[model samples]
Target chain A: MISLTDFLIVSAVLFCIGLYMIVSKHNAIQILIGIELMLNAAILNLVAFGKYDRFNNGGQMFALFAIVLAAATTAVALAIILNVYKQYKTIDPGKIDKLKD
Target chain B: MNLAQMLFYVMSFIALASAVFVAATKNLVRSIFMFFITLFALAGLYVLALADFVAVTQIVIYVGGILVLILFAFMLSGRETLNAMALQQKQFISIGKLPAFLLAALFLIVLLNMIIKVDANNLEWVKKSIESKNDIPVNAAMTEDIGVGLMTRYLLPFEAISILLMLALVGAAHLSRKGRGA
Candidate 1:
């Protein structure tokens, strides 16, 4: 019998790791990965809590939408990253100072 | 412990360990592969949480779709970036990343504290659900229920998501395609 707390702890750890990745990683793609991780963590929380919701299944439904949105966001982000690479010839977000004026 | 509890721990371990590998590994390709394992483990966790449909969706969309997109982006980018990433294998932690490490540690501590304070086992709704036998049972078939809810209660947001997906598809294609006025 795994309590909801176990899942919450796991989700929290995952969220922190994603936050670290987003803050520390230099590459844009790595940041995108971190964002995915964070979103997954949130979705995990939703599913964990949804366990108690027997009738509506709202958590699972919301998780589905979240997953779809994550996919869409990832697609758009990667495309943007590709263009950034093409323009700058580097994916290191730190060096892209074109608009830093 | 029971089978579900054991499996739950195993899946969480796999998910966390691989996620750490994905975060710490210097090799971009290896990290991506680790991410694949992470997503699969998360799907397993979802299954343990009694979300069969969501678990399947996790695998199909995350492992099948997103990972492939990431790999394609990696390939299309260039070799030089990979070389740059490979060269940074000397130190996992440095002064430059100290702030990020601190922030993550603080967040983890706060979240753990909150979760511990909440003590989920004694929650009012959980107790009520248990008393009424309204909680979702293990190995329940969620697909039919989910579909019915989507068509009925969640129909508007479902249609909105379809529109959003279409917009994203068009947007991504347009952004990635070469423009003439460059």
Candidate 2:
């Protein structure tokens, strides 16, 4: 049988990778992808822990809700990214320095 | 190792590797592809974990809905791939580079250490996990359990999420719409 440690380790690796992307990548879309990775890591944790709670299944329910929320968030975020690209003519977050005093 | 353990490791490696590539790759379109790989691998992991509903949902919603929408946004943005990859490796090789790597490494080490140091068998839940009674159901219906729970216990959150999704759609339409105002 697969252990919860396996799941946790995977999530940890994914979360760190997502953090690296968020910190290193300048592209707005890449940053959004990083955010999704981080969110998926958390959702993975929820489902992993929920493996034991069959009577309640709260964790699985939370994961379901999280997946829905993630989709909604990505839609709004991508739309904002598109608007940024429209205004700045570039999707590089480093170059879009309008608010950076 | 058993077949389930083997499958878990394989899927996890695929998910982690592709996730790293999604962040590391310079080609934006390639990153999207890598992201797809990562999500698909994660879905596989979810299945191995016996989260069948969540696994299928991840594939349908993430790979189908969000990914298509993301591709559409990229197309609408009208960025040529050549110009997109024009941003050099300077940012990656800069002063903040090594520290970021060290930080991520440290975090991974800390988390792994914590997980290893803790005795899983001692936990209240882990004790029961051995019985396999409360574990994922092979015969039980997830649809009924989840549906009934959502209606009776999680109804408020369900309704709230519907409202949230509606608001998000409206906001996305407004934000992406052209020539509204400054």
Q: What TM-score would every model get versus the actual structure?
A: 0.94, 0.91
Per-residue alpha-carbon lDDT of candidate 1 for residues B105-181, written as tens digits (9 for 90 to 100) = 99999999999999997999989987887789876787999989999999999999999999999999889887753
Off by over 4 Å in 2: B80-85, B88-95, B128-132
- List the pairs of residues colliding in candidate 1: none
Predictions' DockQ, in order:
0.75, 0.68
- Predicted structure 1: lDDT: 0.89
lDDT of residue A99 for candidate 2 = 68
Best by TM-score: 1
How high is the TM-score of chain A in each model?
0.94, 0.93
User: What's the distance in Å from true for residue B123, model 1?
Assistant: 1.8
Give the whole-model CA lDDT for all candidates, comma-separated: 0.89, 0.82
Taken in order, the candidates have interface RMSDs of: 1.7, 2.0
Chain B of candidate 1 vs. true chain B, TM = 0.90
> What is the total number of backbone clashes in candidate 2?
0
